[model samples]
Target chain A: MARIDLVDLAHAYRPNPTTDADYALRPMNTSWRQGGAYALLGPSGCGKTTLLNIISGLVVPSRGHVLFDGVDVTRLATEKRNIAQVFQFPVIYDTMTVRENLAFPLRNRGMPAAAVAARVGEIAELLDLNVDLDRRARALTPDAKQKISLGRGLVRSDVAAILFDEPLTVIDPALKWELRSKLKALHRALDLTMIYVTHDQTEALTFADTVVVMHDGAIVQMGRPNELFERPEHTFVGHFIGSPGMNVLPAKVEGRTADVGGVPIALGRSYSAIPPGRKIEIGIRPEYVRLSSGEGVPVRVERIDDLGRIRFAKVRLGDARLSVVAPPGVRLEDDRSRVSFDPAQIHVYADSRRIEGDA
Target chain B: MDKPINNAAWFLILPAFAIVLFNAVIPMMTVVNYSVQDSFGNNQFFWNGLGWFQELLDPSSELGGRFFASLGRSALFSAIVLAVQVPLGIAVALSMPRSGIALALCLVFIAMPLLIPWNVVGTMWQLYSRSDIGLLGWTVNAIGIPFNYTNSVLAAWTVLVLMDTWHWTGLIALLCYAGLKSIPDAYYQAARIDGASRWAVFTRIELPKLRSVLLIGVLLRFMDSFMIYTEPFVVTGGGPGSVTTFLSIDLVKIALGQFDLGKAGAMSIVYTLIILAVCWVFYTVMVTPENKGARE
Candidate 1:
């Protein structure tokens, strides 16, 4: 395994990109530590796959260097880079048995027959494919085929990293959880630096130690799952991560108070040095915003979603809509209720980017 | 709920059935009628009752000996054509550019020969291989190989095979190209990641993916070449001797040239049955294993 570094890496499918919009992946520098599991999480067309492809050497970046363990491999072919990639769809040699499918990479590298067999046996056992080892790959279900694809990558011990590009896309939903857990177990057992690209937030949060949240061709935040949940560096991350996502509402901030549509809300920290003529907003998680009968900012309850164990109130304060967690014992007599935000959980934003305030 | 039975739906296909009856079934019945009777001129037929079929099947009889010889020749020609065309077509397909203006140009060029009329192809090759005025025969003879298709059986066979290859290898190549196109880019990317060699990629991935399309190409080429008559008849006239007299040519010579309707009809039935049997066997052998695996 090797540490992969992207030094000012950027890519554009077009000839010469002049604007940020022209680039598929914006210029950025980041390092993935060896033996760490990282997930590149974003929505469709968010350049997560582009970044993963760049790391795998499938697409050469329009600018910048890819350094694997501090050696420049920017122009290297995928085979020479010692990287393995499992694509969105399972790719297997249909004519070959599962044993031969797993053995392919090892044999291609000229590994001895005994060693190939041993490695194949190990991988088949690890993937629970030992029983179907002699069966042709064409006859297997999609999940089994995907397991063989993963086993092919795992059988080779010298791979620098294993990249997964939404590899569970074609799997049945019931099997997605099982295969996902199996992958996490594989990462722990093999200790290989794995980069998984996915659009699903749950998959990313569950699989990676560090999740890199991307939006509009740029990485918005790179942190642990909880770090992303608690503090989003950019407004996009705040709006993209959580289940209902963090609520971002336009407001006017001055000193230790913010005004949302003429309704004043208290802030825990002061932002006296706020820049002139910029879009100001405040973000808070629905979990931290409690709906109650106590004295707070008055809101009109639009609807209440009863989610089995908990309920969330979709409320409107003046003109701004917000989602607030409704307390289990509290009941709204009418469509009106009071919603309070925990001061510490409130984050201030300027021009769609988070800004620090003096405590 | 009980399902509605729709027996009336069968009437909807009557138009198609009528078309087939007129175009195929009626003509085949006439041939069958001719096969079972002896006919002299004036459309007068007498009951022959398997006399022609029995004679055609007996190798000691004149018609039987001629029929067997021509059948063997046609089968051999088909085998040679398949052996040469399939691999060459695959190679051409593999070498084609994946995309861009060049790919469009290559597709059009490969499709040119297939677009020509069959009789036109026969006539073109007939003139193109003439020793006196043709470029191919004249150039070969100029290069110190005494090649004349009219007089030499080997030369005639070579010309016939080459003409057929030139006229039809494009069909196989185009089919193979289409098959190759249907393969996802992920397979090649995965193969590269696996460090597979070029030959390994072709054999393990491409060839297996191409099996279904190649089956279609083989069957089409086999039936077309097995029933081949026009080009060889145009070029050799089954000549110098009976060297290139394939089944169709021999049958035509009997039915039209000599007007022996009974013998010709029997030969035609046997020839068609042979083709149908071979196709059935080939299709079963190739498709059954994969279908069995699929069912499991």
Candidate 2:
């Protein structure tokens, strides 16, 4: 695995950036290991694509360096970066046949003709495009064109890394899973360094080994997919990376006891540092909260949505509307219900920053 | 994509058909009528079946020499215009900025000459090429050379070719620009990844994609140059022993100036047929079966 280091990389499209707020990508340092499949996940207008472009050398960083294998490539053009990129839309040459589209890069690099054909043959088969090798790219469906685009990047086995920029955004939803699975399989088989950028959490979680969560222009957190799901370091990370997102409630804290909406909540684990502050908020995933017939915080259940596999209890705890996921076997009770949460599953925050003290 | 064919489609299409009939088909029919019948005065007419067509096609007649010479001249003029314009337009389009105010500025400047009325373009060049008052002719005359376009075959051809280029190159450039603009940023990305040179990117990604527009541009330029008039008439008046006389000039000379309506009509039909035939050949050869739906 090659080590990629970004040393204080910052970018601003404007001529003069007067402050950190002016930067489109806030200056930061981070490294991704070689052979790691990492996803940069964030909403639109966030710096995920910007960061991906920076790494791919499509955009020169306004400040600092991008080191690949400990060599600075910050000033290098994208052509010299040796990185493959799949764009949001399929970019295969429409005039070329499916095989020609896949073989273009290899032929450009002066690969032997036999080898180019052999590799194109392999990639086409992997993408299930073998039968259409002789068919012109123009005659294919949108998904087929995308497969050619994918194969064009992957056909060159010598690329240092593959950078995917929302490659599946144009795909129909039904085909998204099939393509994602193909990408995941390709990554496993090739063991190439791949960096994917997407706003969809399911895509990010399914394809990448490590997930990098970004907000505004800065990276909020980076960890394994399960690590991100289980223990998000930043409040934005928890909120941005999950379905229905994590429910955040304003809270107050002192010593061992955490008061959320002026109701006492227990913490099973202790922390060395939770700074007492104003603007504190409590974060919890909707699936983590439990609604049972046991004694706990009293709440009035306003609505229950019974989805096929689970039920969502939209409960009123004081002025807050909170939802708890019930497993398939349990039926949610009346308007008045008691809601309880696993104390160890709790993550408390103060002033938008996660409290380090008690879980 | 399927729709049932209905007679109601004719109701929707009738106005369009009427417009074409009024504007194009009727004029063509008039040319056909004149081709067969002789016109003596405003009211008198006589049937001269194939009489003028025979004379125009005969090597012994002056009409034959003029017809052949004009055909050769028109072909050469069209060839030179295409050779000069398409590449020049593509180059200008390539060199322009891709976005922002700079792109708008380039577009406005390129579009400036195309907006000038055709006859105004002819008039402008007419004045600009005069030995007495025109700057270019005056400068040439001061350099100790006679620079009268009305009398010099070289000067006449230069003025006509340059004027046509100046007036119409913008159209080609705009068309090529549209073709260039429609290319997704992705192909460039793929090229960049492929380590393609600038020339390679242009040839492999840009030019092949521009094939359809190039086809249109060439056909359009050919049709326009072959039928060209007005500008040459204003500037050279087909002088200097008819060195710059294209077929349209001779057609106008025959029908209107000499009142040889039958021969002129026959020549006009022949000229139109020649233009249609050449353009059809170009279109078929350049853009037929192989490249149909070549681009998605």
Candidate 3:
């Protein structure tokens, strides 16, 4: 096991990249500690897979070095780097039996035949592939094939890390949950450094202790799951993490008060000397917004979605349309509605970035 | 309650059936009819019954021994062609460029020989292998080896095999290249991650994926070689004293050269049955259990 560090890493598919747009992954520095489970979450084309490939040594960054345990391995090939990766599609040796498929990596690394067999047996049992061990990998279901892919990675004891690139995408929906929980359990049992790349928020939130949210070739935030939902550092994270996401409203701030449309609201903390051209907005989660009577901004209730546990009220306050999650027992006054933001849940942003100290 | 059976669905197959009947069935039926009887001029066919078949099967008979000799020769030619071409084609395909202008150039070059007419290929090789004027023959002789394809049986056989390989190996290579290209890059990436050696990657991943396409290559080459005629017939003309007379050339000689229609027809029927049985056996053996689903 090793700690993977990306030092000022950036990549471009083109030979000569003169502009930021030419780069697939923007320059950034981050380190994944040994034995930590991390998720790199982003939308499509957000460079999450590029980052994973860089860490796995499948890709060499144009401008920075990848260090594993402080050893420069930027130019090392994947085999020499000793990293294992499970692709989106299950990649198994179709001609080989499941036992051979699981034993491949071990044998490739020059392990003894007896040890390879023992390790293959252990992993096959762990993956519930014991019964199909003698069958050809091509005849198995997709989920079973994926389990062989996982077992191939797991069988190698000296692997630096295991990387998963949307490995559950091809699995049946019912089996996705089971595979994900099994993966989480494996991480806990093995305590290997695993970096999972995915676009699904639920998968990331459920699997990783730390979620790294990326946007437009750069990481926007890196925090615990709850931290990302409650205190998103960027507007992209605020809008991406939650089910309906956090609602961001334009506001003008001066001193300790901010104007939401025409109505002035008191800030949770005082601010001094505000800049003129910087964009300012206040964000509140739908779960934290409440129906108010006397204070808060006035809104008109547009629609209400009655989910089993929570009722989501879609309300409009002037030019901004917002969604407020209300409990099943709470009723919204249909025509004229006022929603209040919780002081602790109210997050302020300037120019799309959270105003850390000001908040 | 029984659902109505639409007999119209059976009629939907008529066009394909009609095409097959006009192209294959009629010609095959004529051969079968000729096989069972003797035709003496004036379109009069005498009921020979199994007379021609019995003669062809008896080893002591002239036609029987000649037919067996040519059949064995044809089998050997096909075996040699397959042995050389399959591996050679796979090697070329593996080394071919993956993309860019180089790949386009390679594809165009490989397809050139296959596009040439069969008779043209024959005539070209006939002149090309002449020791007096041909570059190949003159060079080999100039190197102090007495080489004359028309005179020596070994040289004739070698020239025939070489010419066939030159003409058709490209087809096999092209098919294999296409199969290799269809494989996604992820498989290779995963193999690299698993620390598989180059040989392991080829045997475990690439070879397995290529099984179906290679079977096609084998089937095409096998049938073409088994029925080979025009190229060798034009170049050697069954010359060098019957040394290069394959089954098809022998059949043509009997049917046209000697006008022995009954014997030629019998030989043709046996040849067709042999080819069909071999191809069916190969196709069945090569297809994996999992691939059965894809075939359906």
Candidate 4:
């Protein structure tokens, strides 16, 4: 397997892209360490799939090079690049038997028949497709067909990487977890470099060792799932990584104290270098915002959503709405309430970029 | 427990029943009646139950031999047309532009042949194959080949087959094109990732996906060409000693030209049964699991 590198990769669907808006993938450089499971997580049309396609050689980047273990393969066709990819939908060969479907990739490369059959048998057993090996692919259910798609990719032993483009979108909800755990198991067993693209945060967080959070066409942060959750380098990552997301309140910062809305709050870290004209905001995850009795920002509780284990209280301070997690049986009786933020959990952002501060 | 029945639903089906009665049932019954009886002048009829069918099926009889010979010709014509049209149609469909203004233009031009009426097509080919004045005949003659559709059996058969091909290959190609368009882009991408060659992609992915539509095309072509009468009738008129006369033309010649209604009716029933049997066999074979599983 090869360590993949994207050097200054940028792609545009249209010819002659002169601005960032015209590019599907804005200029950026990133690399995937050998044998690491990474997830490119983003909202729809954020160019995660474009980046995956570039890596798979399905689409050439408009202005960058893709190197596999330091070899420039920018102009190589997908067949020559030795990559495997599973698409968003199940794409099994409808006419072939399940066994033959698994053997297709190896046979296409002119592998010996015995080797192909052995590989097919191995992948079929791994995917629980042994009994249905002789069945027509069209007759199986969607999940089974998707398993065949995975099997086809896994059948090839020498592929540099296997890229997945939202492969579980069509799976049943209950089976999604089973297949995801199976994928994680397969990663551990085979130790193949894998890159999964998805918009669902849970899928990204649970499957990837490192999650690359993207917005608009550029990566906002790339770190371990917990790092992305704890210390988001961009406001987009802070707002996108968690359940109910992070609450961002506009702030006026000077030295170590800040005024949020109308109340002056003590800063946990210094933001003295932040200029006066720049827009400054304080970000805190919903998990860290707590209800207080005496000292905190005054808020009007609007609604409380009970989520079985934890509840989210929607509160408003001035015109901004913020979510605070309340324990199982907390009551919100009065219209006015006080909520406090943990100093270590607070993040400062100026112009959507996380400003440097002491943790 | 007795179930409550809604008799009013019967009223809703009355229109369809009446249409079928006038369109299909009446003519079928009349044909059955004609097949079982002999008719003379002045509305006089005699009961001849099974006599015409017996004569038509008996190979030793003159009418039976004629019927068998014409049926063989019809089968051969259909086989040749299908063999030529299906592959050619698939190739043309594969070469067609996928999108943009060129796709629309290609579709319109390909559909032009199918839009021409059957009789008009027949008459056009009749004049177009004239050895003295027609472009094709004159060109062949200029190239040192004596081609006269009126006098040579080979020339007449070629013109007949060529005319039919030109008239109907477009329909098959259009059906195949629709099938090709329905396949998603993901299949091609997956094939590319799997390192499949161009031929592998076509045989494994494109051809298999086109199976159902190709079945439809084959069935339609077989049945239509088996009963073909119009174009050949107008252009060749079973010329050069009946070499190009197909089943429908022979049936017409027997019933209308020779006034043998009972025999013709029997032949017509037999022809329809043959077509139905072949179509059923084709449909079953095309959709069976064995055929699907046989691919690798």
DockQ of 3: 0.59
> Mind giving the per-residue lDDT tens digits that candidate 4 earns over A1-359?
99999999899999999988999999998899989999999999999999999998889888989999999999999999989999999999887889888999998899999998888998888889999999888878999999999998888888899999999999999999999999999999888999999999999999999999999999999999999999989888988899889888898887677778777767688776776787899888999888755568788878899887778999888788999996555567755578887877888899988887753
For residue A359, model 3's alpha carbon misses the true position, in angstroms, by 7.9
Order candidates by DockQ, high to low: 1, 3, 4, 2
Range of the 10 consecutive residues with the lowest summed lDDT in candidate 4 chain A: A327-336
The list of candidate 4 runs beyond 4 A from truth reads B1-3, B290-296
* Candidate that would win on DockQ: 1
Better of 1 and 3 by lDDT: 1
Q: Could you tell which candidate, 3 or 4, scores higher by DockQ?
A: 3
Best lDDT among the predictions, by candidate number: 1
DockQ of 4: 0.57
Task: Score every model by TM-score.
Answer: 0.97, 0.92, 0.96, 0.97
Per residue, candidate 2 scores C-alpha lDDT tens digits across B1-296 of: 99877786678988999999999999989988989988887768899899878887886798887788888998899999999999999998899899999999999999999899878999999898889999888988999988888778888888888899999998889999999999887788778887887888898789888988999999999999988888788777777788887888888888889998788889988887887899889999987645565543
Global CA lDDT computed for model 3: 0.89
| Model 2 per-residue lDDT tens digits across residues A1-359 | 35689999889988789987788899889998889999999999888888888888878988999999999999888877778888888887766788888888888788899998899999998999999999888788888888888898888887778889999988999999999999999999998889999999999998998998888899888889888877777778888877656777876655556677789877656654655445777777878888765768888877778776667878888888887785454454554457887777777776666766634
How high is the lDDT of residue A57 in model 2? 84
Candidate 1 chain B minimal-lDDT segment of 10 residues: B287-296
- Candidate 1: where is the Cα deviation over 4 Å? A329-333, B3-12
